[model samples]
Target: MSNELYHKCHEAISQGRAILEDLQQWDFETIIQYPQAEPQSTASHLSTTAMPSTEKTTLAEMESGLKGCSLCSLAKQRKNIVFGAGNPRARVVLVGEAPGREEDEQGIPFIGEAGKLLDKILLAMKLSREEVYICNVLKCHPPGNRDPQPDEISACEPFLKQQLALIKPELIITLGRFAAQELLKTTQPIGKLRGQWHEYEGIPLMPTFHPAYLLRNPSGKRPVWEDMKKVMQRLG
Candidate 1:
């Protein structure tokens, strides 16, 4: 097998082991709840006026309508807008920072190596991609895989808000610093934000390290698995 394939297999094994350990330690009766962070202000950047007319109900319709969007400069470089995917009625939604190279190319959210890691994580939770919707804060990828700019997020957040309104998910998991910070409207770093419960538009939100970060720093898998356990329990 190629070196890349070999490393991926090894990483999977390590992650699986961590998951098993977490499961072994889990107690169905004894709930371990983290302290709730301060409630974030519910003031939305996107008002009712920003919502598309009632005619655009389905995600497909919204995506189609946004085909020629040039709300931000990122649209200029994007091959395709990585619109969200998975079960429309999914109880959980995973939001990341923005589309990566692979995601941008495929016009699918979380379809890259990070996405594979995410699939493994969902499996660990006894969940599948089909069970949860996945998308990013920014649909179009930034140039050179850079961090999303404020203007870009401002231009894109309305659509994300619309998506949440449609999905009305029971819970949201924000991956990476940007996703968590942006949604919560906080300046706290991901390290402090993660492992604690927060809220977004009344739905429970959990912030955790992104799968891409875990790939770079495999040691982070343990904490991420812990976070997933909390998510599973909350969902149940």
Candidate 2:
């Protein structure tokens, strides 16, 4: 594991555990603080002339649509759009939450420490990155790698929908809570939402623990692997 990933996972685990200690004494609303996004980048004006009105029919088309996209506030701060990479006609598509620091730097999704683990999971299923399409719910990395805000999701959702339409994959796998909740349109926690079959735009969808989560909680790897088995069978 990279030092950055290890440290992040460690911190998240520790902080999460600390919160659990006070689970019984929680006052729900105040405990969950929604942060207002400060000006992370100079806001840019979006021209509808550049935006795609009709559905994009190819990866190239989707790329064109995102080339200069500034529909949401994330556009100004992003290094690269992180459009997605893999077979355009892939049988499986995996959606993650948002680009992390490494991902933003590389302009690719799932190329960090968590991404390496995701590769192993794919290998376990007798697959490679070439066989599966990988992307995020949002194209841009959220400032500070925080959860994507509502406006960000709304702006990015159309692109994701376009990708799914073009690829027409047999299955879609959602990596973490954010992707799961966004795609499922639910407020339930990941613990309650994962390990079940869901659907999106007629394609079968599965929600599982993200590799980052597994990195922090090694015990989670087993259940994630179990989910992969089901994925393998479905692919066959």
Candidate 3:
């Protein structure tokens, strides 16, 4: 595929993830008011800026707000957006870094080999995909499967905040260094980040190695399992 076409595919993937991020917001209502003559120009508030204040919010409406967003350049190269799947009101939520090549292609989080392993891990937790909501810090795949850029994360923050605000999950499990670090707003390494409980928006967060990491270092699986067991114990 030509470079232009390839990048366009990634842009679409981003759009897909943004839609998924907003899907569950349909369950809750936010106050909506008419906008003024001119809205402020802010990348972080891209979605809300275009729309009036919402008393009742829907994922569809949220998605509409994000339409035509160019808060960051990532939008230009995206093919589709990947959204979270499963229960909207789930008690647990899992956050990852960004879409991989496979995730971007499918516009679904965790559908690749790593996702398959995540499935098994969920099974070990005595949970199914239906019981939780899954998403990434970035809705779109980073070009070349690289780590998410700071500007991209900044642009996408509102979508994530809205999801957390709406779902109000009892526990949040962060996968990988970026997800954990970004959520924690710390530069600490994943080694220091994992194996403990952190807080985000008043919800309990547990950091663990990404399935991709476990694939690279099989020894990491045991710790991830231990972390899940802690999460299971906490749920009880």
Give Cα-based local distance difference scores for all models. 0.85, 0.84, 0.82
lDDT of 3 by residue, 1-236 (tens): 99999999999999997876785464322444655656555544444433322232655455555544556766667776775676778999999998888887877899998999999999989999999989988888889889887778877877888877777899999999999999999999999889999999889999999999998899999999999999999999
Q: For each candidate, give its TM-score against the true structure.
A: 0.77, 0.78, 0.75
- Model 1 residue 62 lDDT score: 77
lDDT of 2 by residue, 61-85 (tens): 6686566677777877889999899
**Residue 144 alpha-carbon offset, candidate 3, angstroms:** 1.2
User: What are the per-model numbers of colliding residue pairs?
Assistant: 0, 0, 34
Mark the regions of model 1 whose C-alpha exceeds 4 Å error after superposition. Answer: 1-55
Q: How many times do residue backbones clash in model 3?
A: 34
Better of 1 and 2 by lDDT: 1
Alpha-carbon deviation at 19 in model 2, angstroms: 57
Candidate ranking (lDDT, best to worst): 1, 2, 3
Superposition error at 25 for model 3 (Å) = 19
lDDT of 1 by residue, 103-122 (tens): 88989999889999999999
- In terms of lDDT, which candidate is strongest? 1
Top-scoring candidate (TM-score): 2
Model 3's TM-score against the true structure: 0.75
